[model samples]
Target: MYDHRKLGRELGLFDTDPLIGAGLPYWLPDGAVVRHSLEDYIRTVERRAGYQHVYSPALGKRALYEISGHWAHYDEDMYPPMDVGGEQVVLRPSLCPHHAVMYRSRSHSYRELPLRMAELGAMYRSELSGVLGGLTRVRCIHLNDAHIFCTLDQVADEAAAALALIGSAYRAMGITDARYRLSLPGAGGKYVAAPDMWARASKILGEVLDRAGVPYEAVEGEAAFYGPKIDIQVGDHAGRESTLSTVQVDFHQPEQFDLHYIGADGARHRPVMVHRSIIGSVERAVAHLIEQHGGAFPAWLAPVQVAVLPISDAQEATAARLRDRCLDADLRVRILSAQDGSLGARVRETRLVPYQFVIGPAEADDDAVAVRLRDGRRLPALPAGDVIARVRALVQAHDTRLWD
Candidate 1:
C-alpha cells in the first residue's frame, strides 16, 4: 500500500509544522520543482487550447460570495469574514465567483463566445482538523480552475471539449483507472431552488458523457451548489475515492451575476458558465501522483530529471561540464560526487532520477559517459552531447520511455 503522506515525508517532498497548523503543508524544494513543472505544463496546454490566463485576488469582498450564492450555500466551509479597512472581506472558497466578475467586467459579442479564461489560482476551505490529514484536504488550495463563457447553444460542445482536455491531461500524467461520475444534486442538500436550471444543466452534462461514449455513474448530492458536474474520480491507497478533475455546466451564476453577450440578432442574451478543472487542486493532484508513481515520477515531471555522477575526483571537471550542459538545456539536474558516497551508492541513492550519467576515467578520457536508467537499464558510453540531447528530447515530449 502506497500512502502519499508517508511517501511525501520519506521523499522530502512536503512537510507540515505544528506552528503553521495542519492542512497547510509547505512544499520543499523538490516538491516545488514537481509542482512548478506541473503548473508550467498546464499553462502550455491551456494556451494551446485557447485559454486566456488571469490572476485574481485570493481575498474577495463579503458581498462577492453572497452574490455568487456561495455564502448562502457554502458558508460553513468558508473562513470567517474579517474587517479589512472598515469593510468585511473573506478568503474566497471558490474561483468561479471572481471569474463571473471578470466576465461581467467587459461586454462580449457573439464572436467572442466560448471565451475560455483559466487561472491556477488559490482559494481557501475551512476544513475540520480531523479531515486535514495531508495534501488531500487543506485550508489553502491552488486549483487548476477555468470558466468558459459561451452561448447557451455552445454549452454542450464546450463541456465536451473540457472533458476531452481533462482526459488528455490525465493520459499525459500517466493517470489511468479513474472512473467518470455524473454528480447531481440530491433531494436534501442546500441546493439552488431552480429545478428547471438543474434539469437543463444535468441533461447537458449527461449528453456530453453519452456522446463521449464513456460509462459513468449518476451520483446524487455530489454536485456544486448551482450546477451538475462530471467528476473524474480516483482512489487512494486505502480505497478511498476522491475527485481529481471535473467539468460542470452552470446556468445559475450567469443569472446571479447578470452576465450577458450581444448576439448576432443585436439583442442581449445570457452566456452559460461552464466550470472545469483539469486537475481539481494542485495539492491533491500531487498527493495522488506521489502515491501513483511512488515518487518515481515520469521524466518530464521528475524533480531531478538527471543525475551526473563522477566516479572519482579525476572526473569532477567532466561531471561539471555535463551538469552545465543539462542546466543550459533546462533540465533539473544534480551532480553526486565521490564525497557523497561510492559510485554504486550514489546511483542507488538517486534511484528515482530518470537518467544517470556515470563519469568514469575512461569515459572522461573518451569524452563520453556511461548511462544508467532508473529502471536498471545500462547503456555503453555515449557522447555527452548525444546523451543530453536524448534526455532533453524525452523531457520535451513528456515521454515516459527512458531510452529508444
Candidate 2:
C-alpha cells in the first residue's frame, strides 16, 4: 500500500504548515498542475452533458443558511460569523443555498423542465482537528458541485441522466466497481421539517434507482438533514471505504425558499432539486488518485509526462529541441543533462519520473528518440513526431496508465 501523505510531501504536491492551521492544504506548483487538470476534466464532461457553469461568492449573509435550513441542522460544521458592519456574515460551507437563490432569480416556464448548473466552487468547513488528514480531509475544499432543477414529472429521467454522468467520471478515473448505497434518514438522524417528507423523498429516489436497474443497498439513517441521497462508495487497497460521489434528492429546500415554476396548466408547482458531486472534493480526489496509482499516475494525468535526458553534454542541444517539441504539443516535459554521471545513473534518475525520453548523439543524427515507458518497456528509435502523436492520443482517451 502506498502512504499518500508522505508521498505528497516528498513529491512537492502539497503540505500542511503549522501556521496555516489544520485541515488546510497548501499546494505547490506540481500540485496545482494536477488540480487544474482535474477541474478541466470535470468541466469538459459536465459541459458535454449540458450543464451551464456559474460562479457565486465564497461568503454570504448569515440569513441565507437560515433560510436554507443549513443553519438549523448543520451549524456545527460552519465557521463563526463575522460582524461586517451591522450585519453578520459567514463563509459558505455549501453551495446549495446560493444555487437556490440563483434558481429563484427568474420566472420559469414548463419548457425549461430540466435546468442544470455547475460550479467548481471553493468551500470552507470548520472540521475537528483530529479528523483532518492532508488533502483527504481539509478545512478548505474545491467541490465539483452541481444542481439540477426539474419539474416533478421529469425527476426520474433527470436523476437517471445524472447517474450516467457520475458513472462516466468514475470510469475515467479507473474506479469502476463503486457500489451505490441509497441513504435514507434514520430514526436518530436530523431530518428536514417532517418525517413524512423524508420517507416520500426516499421512496421516490429509490423507485428511480430501481427503474434504472442500478444495484444499490438501502442504508437507513445516513441521509443528510434535508434529504435522502444515493452515495457511491468505493474501497481502497486497504479495504477502507469512502464516498466517491452522491446524488441527493431534496424536497424541503424548494418549499422552504418558495421556489416555483408555472406548469402547462398555468398552476404554480414546486421544482424538485437534485444535488450532486461526482468527484466530491478535488483535494480528496487527488489524495485518492495518489493512493490508487501508488504515486505513479497514468500517462495523461502525470504532472511530468516526459523527462528528457541526454546521454552526455554533447547531446544537450538535441535534448533541448526535443523538450521544446514536447512542450509545443502541450505535454509536460523535463530536461536533465548530467555530464558527470554514468548514463545508467541518469536513466535511473529519470525513472523517478513517470515517463523518460533518452536521446543520444546517434539518435539525434537519425532524427529519432529512444522511448522508455513507466513500466520499464523500451521502444528503440521511434521518430519524435510519432512518439508525440501516440502520447496525445493516450491523453485524449483519458488513459492515465500506460497501454501494456
Candidate 3:
C-alpha cells in the first residue's frame, strides 16, 4: 500500500503540528502547487459547465443552518455555536446552506432555472480526536462544492449531467474501476427529508440512472438528510472504498429557505436543489493523487516537473540559464547547483521529479541538456527550447505518458 502520511512527510507535501492541532494539515510549497493545479483545472471545468463561482463566509449565524434544517438534523456533527463579539455563530460544516441563502437573496426567472453556484469553500466539522487522520479525515476542509437550483422538471437532466462530470474527472485522474451507489432514505434515520418526498426523490434518481443505463445499487438509509444521493465510490491504495464524489438531490432546502423563481406562467415557484461535489476535499484529492500515481504525478499535476542538476561547479552558470529559460516558458523547473551534492546524489534525491536534466561540461559547452526521465529512460542531449516545448505541450494537454 502507498501510505500518504508516510510519503507526505518524506516528500514534503504536508505536515501536522500538535501545537497547531490534529486533523489540520498545513500545506507545504510542493503540496500547495499540486493543489493549485487541481483547483485551476476544476475551476476551468466548472466555468465551461456554466457554474458561477462565489465566495461565502466560513462562519455563519446559527440561525442560517437552523433555517436550512441542518441545525436541527446535523447539529451533532457540527461545531458548537459560539458567541463571537455579540451574536452566536458556528463554523459552517457544509456549503449548501450558505449557497441556498445566496439563491434566496436574489429573484430569478425561468430562464435561470438551472443556476449553478459554486465555490472552493472552506468548512469545519467536529470529529473525534481519534478519527482524525491525514488530509482524508480532517476537521477543516476546502470543499469543491456547488449547488444547482432548477425547476422540478429539470431534475433528471441535471442529475445525469452531474454524474457525467464525475465520470470525466475520475477518467482524467486515471482513477479506474470506480462504482456507483444510489443512496436512498430508509425508515430508520435522522432524515430531515419528508417521507413522501423521499419516495419521489428516490424514484426520480432511479429513473435517471435507468434511462442513462448506469448500474447502481440502492442502499437504504445511506441518504443525506436533504435527499437521496448518487455516490461515486473509488477504491483507495489499500483497496477500501471511499466516497470521493457525490450528486445529491435536495427537496427540503428550497422549501425551508423559501427559494423561489418566476415560473413560465409568471408566478413564484419553488426550485429543486442539486448539491454536487466532484472532489469533496482538495487536500484529500491531492493525497489520493499522490498515492494513485505513486507520487510521480502526471506532468500537468507535478509540482516541479523538471529539475536541472549541474554536474560540477563549472556547470552552475549554464544550469541557472536553463532554469531561468524554463521558468520564462512557464515550466516548473528546479535548479540544483549545490556543489556539496554529487551528480548521483542530487539525481537520487530528485527521483520522484517527473523529468530531470543533467548539465555536464560537454552539455554546457553545447548549450544542451542530457535529459533523464523518472521512468529510467535517458534521452540524447536536447536544446533547452526543445525541452521546454515538449514539457509545455505535455502540461497543456494533460498527457501522462511522457516516455511513450
**lDDT, residue 381, candidate 2:** 82
Error of 2 at 60 (Å): 1.4
Better of 2 and 3 by lDDT: 3
Q: Write the per-residue lDDT of candidate 1 for residues 277-396, one digit (tens) a residue.
A: 997899999999998999999899998999999999989998998899999999989999989999889988999999999998989998898999999999999988989998899899
Those runs of model 2 whose alpha carbons end farther than 4 Å from true positions after fitting are 211-214, 236-239
Better of 1 and 2 by lDDT: 1
Query: Which residue pairs of candidate 3 clash?
Result: none
Q: TM-score of every model? A: 0.98, 0.94, 0.93
| Off by more than 4 A, model 3 | 211-215, 237-239, 338-340
Q: Please give, for residues 351-397, the per-residue lDDT of candidate 3 as tens digits.
A: 88888988888899888888999989999998878878888887877
Ranking by lDDT: 1, 3, 2
Better of 2 and 3 by TM-score: 2
- Runs with alpha carbons beyond 4 Å of true place in candidate 1: none
